[model samples]
Target: MSIDRRRFLCRGAALSAGLLLAPGWRAWAQSAPMLDPAARQARAVRYVEQASAAQDDPAYRAGRRCANCDFFSAGQRCSLFPEHRVSPDGWCMSWTSE
Candidate 1:
């Protein structure tokens, strides 16, 4: 299949406009987790023993973090642990940098 430049631009513009007009977009964007240390711990976030920790798992790395991981969203919430704010600098066993 082939796509024309004008058609692509129009579709992109429409999508952008749709997102901008969506009433829930603002609320959804603002609803990202706060990533509090205590709350995270209570939720079993394992912030101290993350993949970035010293002497952590073999797949762990020094600078890898949740903000850059595929499982994270909006630099706060995590797909693996929904409704909770995760540290952008935090890591976990499921961390996957992407």
Candidate 2:
């Protein structure tokens, strides 16, 4: 087999691009698991699966929920908890309207 500079450069570029995109591709192809209220990250933010369950918290507001939070994505992923998907009706102290 003969090695060529052009072919080597092209292969290197393709490999680099694939490596860079692999994580994003995996993220897009798989749905994140639902957030568990008992999880440490969830507990840290005082997350509740249902907004109503957060009533005891001073930060809870009548109409605030994950679906309407600024950090929430349409796919139910919360920026604060990137590895999990939260319930649309979930509430957390980190919730923000901005």
Candidate 3:
């Protein structure tokens, strides 16, 4: 197997182990609601200012956004905030230009 795949599997195992050991994690997992990508993005957008232009903030350049930011991954989620899907046009305090 490729190193990347191995690493991914390892991380998944670690995460699962950690969650299994944490008290109330199973309950939380079972009870927590899941949101659609749009809803998740909407929730995430509350923390990040949605910007069309860099003028919205000093951190942003004319075209900077979650889709182009360093923290973004898989075209949908942000590494900086893993709990929800982030909008491609969203700009947050943690934004880092790629």
TM-score rank order: 2, 1, 3
Pairs clashing within candidate 3: none
Q: What TM value does model 3 have?
A: 0.45
- Answer with 2 or 3, whichever has the higher lDDT: 2
Query: Residues 1-98, candidate 2, lDDT per residue (tens digit)?
Result: 99799999999999999999988866763577998999998999999999999998998989999999999876688889887889999999998985
Backbone clash tally (model 3): 0
Model 1 per-residue lDDT tens digits across residues 1-98:
99999999999999999988676754775577555545645346445324445345565677777777898776367787666666677776676763
Ranking by lDDT: 2, 1, 3
Q: Write the per-residue lDDT of candidate 3 for residues 4-97, one digit (tens) a residue.
A: 9889999999999898777675454434332233455544543454666346555556666677778876636667656655567766556676
Q: Estimate each model's TM-score.
A: 0.53, 0.69, 0.45
Q: For every candidate structure, what is the RMSD over all alpha carbons to the true structure, in angstroms? A: 5.0, 7.4, 9.6
Q: Each candidate: what lDDT?
A: 0.66, 0.89, 0.60
TM-score winner, 1 or 2: 2
RMSD to the native, candidate 3? 9.6
